[model samples]
Structure formats: C-alpha cells, structure tokens
Target: MTMYSVDVYSGSSDSIIQDSHAQAVIVKATQGTGYVNPKCNHQVELAKSLGKKLGYYHYAGGGDPVAEADYFIDNINGYIGTGMLIIDWEGYQNSAFGNTTWVRRFVDRVHDRTGVWCVIYVSESALAQVANCANDCGVWVAKYASMTWGSWTVPNMAVSSGAFKFITGWQYTGGDMDRSIWYLDEAAWDKFAKANVANPTPSPQPKVDQAKPVVNPQTTWTDNLGDTWHAEDGKFISNTALHLRWGARPSASTIAVLPAGSVIKYDAWSRGNEFVYVRQPRGNGYGYVAVRNAHTGEAYGRFE
Candidate 1:
C-alpha cells in the first residue's frame, strides 16, 4: 500500500502535521558539516506525539562526503535506528553536485557507522549524478507535474531510474511543504529503520564436533593506540606537512612527518573512531595518517 509523507525545513512550522494528510513526517535535520535545522526537534516531537512514522535527512553541502555523513550522524545520534535516514542531493551551492561518487561515499559512511543504508533524494533530471549509488541505496526521485502548490494527490507521473529497478519514494508535489508518496507500508517502514547486518544467525544452532573446519575468518587488527584498522585503498596528497601515524586516532604514534605537497598511497583506512585515518603500506606492517577532520571536513590532505 502506498503511504504519504511530508518533508519540512526551518521555514516550516509544527502545524505541518496539523494541516497535511501525510502518515509520515520527514524533517530536514542537518546541512553540510555545520548547520542543523533549528526547528527540527520540535517538528520531530510533534510527529512522535501523533505516532507518525519518522524520517530525517541531511542536505549535502558538497563538502567532504565522509565528514558530512559524520556530522549528520552526530546531530541525529539519538534518532539513529529509529527513523528513515535520507541524503538530500541538490545542486544549489553544492560543490560536489555533479560528482557521481559523492552520494556513494556519503551513504557508505552512514552504513559503515550505523549499519543502516540511507535513501538518496535527487531530482529526476539529475539521476545520472547518483547512478553509482543505485546498487546499495534506495532512490527517492522527485519530479513534479507542475510548480503549483496543491493538496495531496496520488501521483500518476512516471519516475525512470535506469539502474535502480524501483524507487522507494517519490516527491510528487512542491510548495510551502513538499509531499512524497512512500512505496511502502507501515511494517516495511519499520524494517528500513532497523540496523541491517550480514549473515544473521536467527537462532543458536547446535555445534557439531564432527563438522568440517571453518575456512578464512575475517581478520581485523588493533593498533598500539587500541584503534582497529581495516583494509581500504585510496590515494592521498598532503596539502601541508602532516603526520603519518601508527594508528587512526589523533593520539596515535607519529611514524613520520610528510613534507608539504607530498603524495602517498594507502592500502587501508580505520573507522568507528573520532577521526578517519588512512593506512600507508610500509616495510612489514603499515603507517597511518589523518585524511581530514572527521567532524569539520578540514582536510590535512586531499584524497585522490
């Protein structure tokens, strides 16, 4: 069954729920790495009181995708695993507007942190820019029949997403408050709000002593600073003299100091920490370096 939802920003008042026929309420929570919607909390609370399905979105500011993801997660920490997470990909003042990988990286970071894949919101005309994300993230294609502000109506228009087999949501109307048609029922909406994990054992199975030996378990290594590192590949360039460390944290051991304008290749990166550090391949083990300020998107070095 199709359900209705409304998305509101700071300009909107709490009366949105009082005026709309929406069964769900998705509010703008954050933008870039800096701005949080001032009235977000109140709007969310009103929805909660009415027992409406909830959603929160981050408006991409065309900055460091990972940093922006972290910022969005940080502000909406309490609401994680409780509402549908969305990334609003728009071109207004966004520097990364045309980059295909921006939404991919942002949604990847969100899933890595919270175990919940986010839905990508983009206009129908800009579908190509976020095509890379179609495989993992759901698409919420926005295409209005006209620019007129009108009441809720079932959308008859078509949304063509090439790689994405189907859209999870469609924003069909635009005005003081935009309306969307969610292609899911209440139960399905709850499932999207839960954490998604791989190979979950539903119930404990009896151990067999005669079973064949398990092969190739996943391996993770902890650094001297007690930070865990995982294998990842990327190229990095230092804009200034930066410390190559022994771990992912800021307090990790500084292995070497790269001169300004240095370029290095990394084989791995670390997560679940305050800052994200890339690991450079050394003689036997690896060396770590801070790629950017995880919260502020201030890069010590640029990623290639």
Candidate 2:
C-alpha cells in the first residue's frame, strides 16, 4: 500500500503529524558525526502518540559511515513505531573511494545493532554510488518530477531511476521542507512498521565459540593467549555497554560489562572469523567481542 512521510531537519519546528496526512514520518535524526536533529525526538514521540509509524534518516556527511550509522542508531533505535532506518547518502562526493565500502559498513553495523537492515536514501546523482548497496538494503530515492503538493507523478519518476528493487520513497515535493511517498501497500507497509528489528527487547544473542587455534589463514599466528602482539591498528570501545567473554565467541561467558568509550587493544582475529581477541581495553579480562563494532571503526571489524 502507498504510504507517505516527510524527512525533516532542525528547521522543521511545526507539528509534523498534525500538519500532514502522511501515515509515517522520516525525521532527520542526525548529521555528520555528533549533531542530532533537535525536533526528531518530538516528531518521533508525537508520531507514537498518534499511532503513526515512524522512521529516521541520518545525513551521511563526508565522514566515517560506520560512525555515522552508529550515531544515527543511538539517537533513535528503540521506538515502538520505528518503520525503517534510512541512510541519507546523497552528498558524499561522486562515488569516491571507500564510499560504497563505508556505506555497507554503516548498513551492516546498523543491522548488527538493531537487528534491522537499513535502507539507503539517495538522489539520482548518488543512486549508483554504491554497488550492491541495495542487495541487502532497500533504496529510497529522491528524483523530483514536480514540486507542487499534488505532484504524485514524481513517485513514478523515482521508480524509473532503477535505484532499488522498488523505490521505498519518492520525494515529490521540495522547498522549505521535503515530502515523499513510501511505495509499499498497506499490508506491505504494515510489515515495514516493525520490519527492521522491532524487538523491543532483542533476544539474548547466543554465543558462537571461536576458540580454535588457527595456525594460518591470511598470516600465521600463534594461539597462545599471552603471545606478543603486533600493531594492526588502535581503537576504543564505543558502545555504552559491551560484553567481555572468557572465549572468542558470542556465547562465551560474560566476564564483564565495559561501558562506552572504553579503550581496547585488539589482539587478533578468532578462528571463526566473527569474534575479535582484544587486550584489556577497559581493564577487563581479555576474552572476545563481536568484530562488528563500527561506531568507532574498531579493528578486526567490518571496517578497516
């Protein structure tokens, strides 16, 4: 079924739900590295009160996409009305090196954190910015065929862009604000209402053991726990609470919980290729953490 929503920035101070007939709203939740949309929480809360589905997007400025994705998720992850996580990828230069890589990093990280795969919002210029971006993510495109409030044809134009399997949204109107139609039917839209990891309390992540002593994969390394380590990179924990385990797997015993910004020294990769062996970055015992903490681009993670 066709759904409508508007993407707003800090300038949108009006009551979005009260002012429009849209079924959902995609508020700009964050920008660049540290800034957040002041009105986003209000919009989300208001949308929730009105029983409207809600969504959010992050303005992916030319920075680390992984960090930006985490920032975006941090701002709006647990909303009961959340329908989608969109990465606004329209203005980060013309398919620059590491652009697709960073976007994918962001997408995968958001999925890992929220259990929902995020969608990408792009203009025609950035439609093909990242190859395989839509393989795992839905694509929301912005190709305005008309600017008037009645311009429903723009959604058709957006579909012609070939940016997605189906265009999630088509920005038909632009000016002081932007508006679009989510191209899903009511049944499909309902599925999207909580489609992206809607579990209010995510089920406990089972631990996957990775304690194998790998003699060689890319480079040879010893399995000794206290072996001398080499420098691949430096990183610190960025999540609010991170689990420390007795082994290099998700199922390892939770030895401790390290708070956000804990400094960690990544020791090596586990045999399973999913967990990371880290030194006592938080003075916690050395065990393992998932290798997908891209908020700060942790080493042995999705991002370099």
TM-score top scorer: 1
Q: Name the runs in model 1 displaced over 4 angstroms.
A: 197-304
On a 0 to 100 scale, what is the lDDT of residue 242 in model 1? 82
Q: In model 1, what is the error at residue 293, expressed in angstroms?
A: 32
Candidate 1, pairs of clashing residues: 232-268
Q: lDDT tens string, model 1, 5-76?
A: 988888776777755488999989999999999999999999988989999999999999999999999999
Weakest lDDT window of 10 consecutive positions for candidate 1: 198-207
Please, what is the whole-model Cα lDDT of each candidate in the order they appear?
Answer: 0.75, 0.57
Off by over 4 Å in 2: 92-98, 147-158, 161-163, 193-304
TM-score of each: 0.64, 0.57
